[model samples]
Target: MLQDYTIKKQPTKTSKLIASIEFILVLLAIQGVLLLFNQEVPTSEVAQFRILANSNTAEDQRIKQEVQKKIAPLLDQAISQSTTQQQLHDRLQHLEPTIEQLAGEYANGSAVTFEHKAALIPPKRIGFAIQQQDVYDAYILKIGKGKGDNWWCALFPKVCYPEEATVTETEEEPVKFFVWEWIKSWFS
Candidate 1:
């Protein structure tokens, strides 16, 4: 004969409370692991490289690309030997004059200034890791007035470069409040 497997009694209040507490504990444990990963993956030791154009004009943007192409190789050579953030920054500082000269030449008369300093980077989700907005060591190259669109990447982590080290960015998903939603689901 076929068996009737349906529940004959609803769970008691105490049992329901126990189940909910267990679920919450599991969620907390998972969140703790995620927090640890976020803290370690995207580090403060990142070094950024940014090229800013004089204006938003096509000519200015073209000059920006030309500079980028020419300067990227020299940077690749300079930072390749460094194993730590301090070493990378020192190398960049040493290479500053050459970098400016190359960019100035590629800029076609546009005024160029190269600075290696601490700069603010907006929050970015590059590949699977989310990099929070913070100040980082950077090499900022300004063309002419330096008021236009800019091209930048975390040179240390290599977010925008493929052959360099590979990382990501292109519209990240928004953060979700899963705990609130989970609680509502239980009530419903």
Candidate 2:
């Protein structure tokens, strides 16, 4: 006959201390990873960019003002010096083709739109014109040229081939067929 003996074991204080330390280390590591995942960049870099842009814009304006001031006297002197109607007529004649083209385009049914830099024109000067295609079809128009190089950078077509236009059959997802309407509607 064989008798089996079962001994009850008690956990030591050393084991408890080791378990507590391991728990604390795991918490610290978790916190560190969380902090890394949700890291916040300092605002000082954004502030610096804003300051630089403002300074450059101010400088550019100052330069333009100076140039205009310097040229004003010369323009006045040239006007005073010239007495011929022939000179004035010649200048007008040069611009006559552009005027005629603009007038012709306006007379025809076309989608016309213009872009300008921010806050250049007063709201009062902004007027809407609609060109009719038939009795019910028409497109709204706005006319103004952009002032800055940056404005035209995206607008102008380059030597490279244009990106392929995506076609959507769904009525909800409208595709652009006209340049002016597309651009105006996109920004607005």
**Candidate with best lDDT:** 1
User: Which digits, one per residue and each the tens of the lDDT, describe model 2 over residues 123-172?
Assistant: 11112322221122111112122122222223432211134222322355
In candidate 2, the residue pairs with backbone N, CA or C atoms under 3 Å apart (3 or more residues apart, or in different chains) clash, namely none
TM-score of 1: 0.57
lDDT of 1 by residue, 25-78 (tens): 998999888777664445566788888888878988888889899989888987
Task: Provide the lDDT at 126 for model 2.
Answer: 12
List the global CA lDDT of all models: 0.77, 0.35
Off by more than 4 A, model 1: 1-40, 150-188
Error of 2 at 128 (Å): 47
**lDDT, model 1, position 184:** 64
